[model samples]
Every structure is written in C-alpha cells, then in structure tokens.
Target: MNKKSLSQQIYEARWCYLFVLPCSILTGMFVLYPIGMSWYFSLLDWSGFTKDAKFIGLQNYAEAINDPFFWNAFSRSFIFMFGTVPVKIILGFVIAVFLNNQVLKLSPFFRTIIFMPVVTAIAIIGIVMTFIFSPFNGPANKFLMATNLTSGPIDFLGNPDTVLPTVMGVYVWKWLGITMMYWLAALQTVPQDVYDAAKIDGAQGYRLWIHIILPIVLPFAIVIILVEAVSALNVFPLIETMTAGGPFFSSEVMEVYIFRTAFVTDAGTMPRLGYACAAGVFWGVAVLFITALQGFWMRRTRRI
Candidate 1:
C-alpha cells in the first residue's frame, strides 16, 4: 500500500473543503472580524461618533483596572456565576437521576415540562417574571400576603438586596434543564451491567451512586460545570430585560457595563466605544483564562 502524497490527499479532500468554505467564510466575516476589530478598538480613544479616534495603548485598560464601577460589575458577574453554577449542577444532576429511573412514569412528559423554559424566549420570560413578581397586583406578592409571608408587597426586581438573587433564581430555572440534559447524556454512558454487578455486591442506593455512578460521571460533571460557569457570565438578555442593571446597579454585569459605556450616552456623557471595547477585551481574556484553568484541571483529573 502506497502512502498518498500531500497533493493527492488535498485533491481527494477538495469536496470536503468546498463544503466547509461557506461556513468558514461566514465565521471569518461575522465572528473573527468583529473580535479582531474589538481588540483594535480597545487600543483607541474614541467616542464612536466621530472619526477622531486617537491611538492610546493600554490607557483604556489602565482606566478599567482603576474604575470602581467596572470592578463592581466584574465582581457581580463572579457572584452570579458562583451563586448559580453550583445549584444548577447539583439540582440538575438530582433531577436527571430521578428522571432516569426506570420506574419513573411519564418521564418524557416531565422532561418536556422541565425543558420547556429552555426553548422559551428569555425576553418573554423576563417580562412575565416581572409581572409575576410585581410589588402590586402580582400573583407572587398576592400569595405571599395570603400566606402571611410578608407584611407588604415585596419588590423582587426593584430592591437591590433581593434583585440579584431574584435574577439568579430565574436564571437557574431557565437553564437548569440544559444541565439536566448534560447529566442525562452522561448517565447513559454508564453500562447497566455495572449497576447490576454493583447491586449484587450490596452497593445499593446512595452507596452505589457514591462509589460507582459518581466516578463514571465525574468527567462529564467537570465539562458541564465549566460550560455552566461560562454561560453564567452571559446573562445580559435576562438581566437587561428584567432589571436593566438598575436598582442602584446591583445587577449590572460586565456586558451591561460595556453596553452602557459604548452606546448609552447620558446627557453630558459621550459614548466611550474605545473604553467599552477595552472592558470587553478584558472580559474575553478572563473567560479564556477560566476555560484554560478548567482544561488544566480536566487534564490533571484524567491523570489521577
């Protein structure tokens, strides 16, 4: 058997390359171009309104590093990620396990019910949630009052103290089903014979899960957690529609901060497109670092 030359291999795979050309072009135009432009813009001092963009290297980044509001938004993003990722992982795992049980009737229906929110528009959900948690004439407040849980109507989306947590809850509820699906896929990888063998060895209930099931699913859990953590940083739509980072900017995350800086010009303020791009670049780097860390951990786990 003769080994094919590079030219021959290229010729043979020409059709495959032809098929991928359109998608590659689209990605280059839409994704790569924007990302490259963002980095370039980050190095400038521009208001996005005029062509007078002065090239200022690292000044925007230095400003961002010292900006209190930027740090506040950054910290809030981490808080949201920390608060929601664990709950989503744990609850999603449990629900997936419950749904995976052979004795569970109408599991498909239950799954559909749980996953319905995932497909629903986030904007729509945000609007509905605001109404539901409205201080006056809302069902949530009405129920709370009826049950005497609170003395007055609670402003869920209005109060800074409760707004972050409220949005986190809604975020968890909206995306929990996706986490469940990940767990379900992981669970399917465990062979039934292994379960039967473990059962025969008296490893039942929690013991079986602790020793056998967990070990099998640990790898999957790592990936799922990383995905959820990254996803938690992308709560712009939900937060935008629900809170608009209001109530004293309690719910303002990095994306909202960037948007406000780049586009939303107040009475006397100019839209700092360059500064916003710097913030965005910083955020992108942070996400890359996190992903790299997770990848390192994954490799280490595999070695162990």
Candidate 2:
C-alpha cells in the first residue's frame, strides 16, 4: 500500500479541525486578546477610560518594583494562600475518607449538604460572613459575649491583626467542599481489591491510609494544591465584600490593589490603569513561575 500524502492526511482530518475551530476562536478572542492587551497597556500611561494612552516604556514597571504597598499586598496574598491551602486540603481529605467508608450511610446527602457552599454564590457568602462577623449585633459576637469569652464584639474584620486570618478562615470554609470532592473522586479510582489485599496482609486503620490510599491520592492532591494556590492568591470578591482591603489596607491582596489602582481613586485623580496593568503583569509572571515550579515538583514526585 502507498503511504498517504500530507494533503491526503489533512483532508481526512478536516472534520476534526472544523469541530475545534469554534473553541479555538473563542479562546483567542476572550483569553489571548485580553492578555495581549494587558501587556500593551502595561507600557502606557493612561486611565482605562481615556483614548489618549501615552507610551511610557518601562517606567510603570520600575515604579511597581519600588512600590512598598504592592509588596505588602503580595505578602498578604502569600499569607492567604498558605493559611487556606493546608487547612482545606486536610479537612477535605478527612471528610472524603469518612464519606468513602462502607460503614457510612446517607453519604450522598451529606456530600450535597457539604458541597452546597461550593456551588453557592461567593458574593452571598462574603456578604453573609461579613454580617456574621460584624462587631455590632452579630451572632458571632453575641455568642462570644454569651460564653463570657469577650467583653464585646471582637471586630474580626476591622483590626489589622485579625482581619487577614479571619478572611483566611472564611476562604477555607468556603472551598473545603470542592476540595473534598476532588479527594473523593480520586479515592473512588482506587481499586477495592487493592484495599482487600492490604487488609489481608495485616494493613488496617492509619496504616491503610498511609501506605495505600495516600500514594494513590497524591496526584489529585497536587492538583488541589495548585488550584488552591491560584485561587487564594487571586482572592478578590470576598475581600471586597467583607473588608474592601480594610480599615488600614491590612487584608489587601494583589487583586484588590489592581482594582483600586485601576478604578478606585480620590475625586480629582485619574485611575492609574497603566500602573495597575504593570503590577498585574508582574504578579502574573510570578504566579506562572510558582505554578511551573509546582508542576516540576509534582512530575519529580511521580518519577519517585
């Protein structure tokens, strides 16, 4: 038989290419276009609304590098990432284990209940949480007062010392359900026969999880870690709804700073669209670097 020519091969796969064309076009339009625009805007000096965008080369980037507030917000982003990731992952894993148990009944109901928060509107959660943690007439404060743990409302979202951690706690709670679903799906992929063999070899209780379940679940855990890292680092809505970066910019993260610089400002000043874009570009590069590092680490783990 004669080998097919390149043209012949292309003709045979034309339908497959056609099927992918729409998705490719949409991705280019929405995702790729914005990224390119952001890079171009980063080199300019203009408010987003203005038609006259002055090209400023690397000045915006230089200013961002020296901006103390940018670094401060970046540090808070790291704190939010670290604080939320481990707690959610561990709690999610534990819940997944419990739900996976044969002895557990009505697990589907429980799963739906737990996962409701994951599907619920984040804006609603942030608003409700703000009220729950409100200094005046909030249930949380009332409970603390009733329990004699405090003299009055603690102002969880007010004080700089407590605001960041409180937000972290809320983030973990909101995301735990989705994290558990990841673990649960990973756990389901493990063969029951493997567990049976481990049991027959005298593996039970913590040993079963340590040796068998954990190894199988590790890849999924890596995915969860990366997802949570990105999500936590880019946190915006909750901070906006609950604290708006604070009483003193205590709970501010990179995203909050970007929004403020881009849109929010004093009465007479123009929004710093270019500066905000510069900050965004810098942090976007940093996030990409961190994610690439994480992927390399996961790949190495798979080899080991």
Candidate 3:
C-alpha cells in the first residue's frame, strides 16, 4: 500500500526475475515461438520447405480425422505405452530396492549401470538395436539359432506383429533406469523400522511390498507414470530412425506421421501443416485426457 512497501517488494522480486530470465527467454524462443509458428503454418497449405502455399481452412484437420494411418499409429502408440509403463514401474521398483539396501557395495556403480543408457545417445542406440534385431546374421537371432530354439531368424523390426513390441522393449530398456533411480531416492526415506516391523508381523515379499513400501512410494510412482506417459506419447526420433513405422506403417507414431506429412512428402500429395497441427492438437488433448485420468486414479488409490 505504501511506496516503501512497494519498493521493498519490487527489490525482493528483482532477484526472482534475474533468476528466471534465462529460462523465460528460452521458453519464449523455442517453445512459444515454435507453437505460434506451427499454429500459423498449420492453417496454410505451405510446403514445409517451399514458398508455394494455399490457405486451407479446416480441410487438413478434416482429412486427418478420416485418415486411417493416423488412427493406426495412435493404436500402435497405445500398445507401446501399455507394454512399457507397467514393466518399467514394477521392475524399476524391484531394482531400486536392491540398489537402496545398505548391504550392497558399489551401489553407485550399480546405479550407473542401470542409468548408463539414459545418458547414452539415443540415435547411436537405435543404430545398434537395428543391427541386433536384424533377422539375418544379427547376434540376437544368431544366439537363438545357436540354442536350437526354433527357426533360423525371426524378424524383430521388420515383422508387423513384432515391430511395435520391439520398439516398446527399447522404450522400457531406456526409460526403466531413470524410473529406478527415482525409486532409489524415494527408497532412502522409507524408514528401516517399517520393514523390520513388517517382518515381525510375518509379512514378506509381495505382501510387505504391497502393504508397506509401495504405498509410501506411491507419489513418486504416480509422478513417474504421468511423465512417462507424456514422454512415450511424444516419441518420434527413434520411431523415425528405427522402424520408420514400416512393414505397412504398423509402428508409425503420430509425431512421425506429422513430420513426414509436413516436411517429407511433396505438397502434391500430403504437405498438410494444418493437418499436422490438428494431429498435434488431437494428441495434446489425448495427453491431457490421460493425465487427468491418471490424476484421478492417483487420488482414488491414494485414499485407499
């Protein structure tokens, strides 16, 4: 209300601005600008790389809805998300319990081993997995062949049935470590006496975990689930690099589909920025929907 009060408030807030300025600028430049640009471009029939254009109102969005490829890619993404998130959460928790125990020596080393892939270049791993999953002469198939386990070679990325699952495998492999590390941090706070008391009550294994530990870790687990769901939805580079959603476009995610539509294909066929934005808007809505449902689930489960 007073000048001095206002001045003091402004003075205090000055450092807040100083601290936040860089992040704000970066968000504006990269995030806000691109979103606005994408929305603007989405309204046009602009070839992503060229100057030729037309203003198509709702046409692209209309086409995107009826497009079979859009729905197919979305379905594959859902499959990938369903496959990876549960396995990652369960395995990560189990691994975190082991890593957090005081009895373990070289805990940091083990932690690093689990988390190494998270830091490793995704592009490089894509190339490596491509070779490993190669039907012929790849080590994976070769090992299976060596063991007399059925056929000579099984197509991992090439086969329609297997491609989505293979990508899901890669998704879990890469993401599990990060989730495990989060669990390990949460594990440290779980009082040791709780486990001892559970043992005294004759509880062990799954019973102890279900009744005691998992509940304590519920918040972290929920956070990880929400983040993973959002990240998994946006997965594109690996989809592009690895499968290209090939074998009749079985694994093409929405992001990859949009990228190809906007930039790769010529305007003569499918350079539909508006369609891509519509796809993005639809995906964004789906993400929000899932997140909302997850939040509701967390609240419901938390009460129990």
Task: Provide the TM-score for each candidate, comma-separated.
Answer: 0.95, 0.95, 0.88
Assess the local accuracy of residue 206 in candidate 1 as a C-alpha lDDT between 0 and 100: 89
Off by over 4 Å in 1: 1-8
lDDT of 2: 0.90
List, residue by residue over 50-153, the lDDT tens digit for candidate 3.
67878887776677789999888777778778778789888998898888876889878988988988987777777888998999789889998989894769
Q: Is candidate 1 or candidate 3 better by lDDT?
A: 1
Q: Which residue pairs clash within candidate 3?
A: none
Task: Estimate, for each residue in 170-189, the C-alpha lDDT of model 1 and write its tens digit.
Answer: 99999999999999999999
Candidate of highest lDDT: 1
- Please tell me which model should have the higher TM-score, number 1 or number 3: 1
Among residues 3 or more apart in sequence or in different chains, the pairs in candidate 2 whose N, CA or C atoms overlap within 3 Å are none
Any runs in candidate 3 off by more than 4 Å, and if so which?
A: 1-15, 199-205, 266-270, 299-304
Stretches of candidate 2 off by over 4 Å are: none
How does model 3 score by TM-score?
0.88
lDDT of 2 at 151: 90
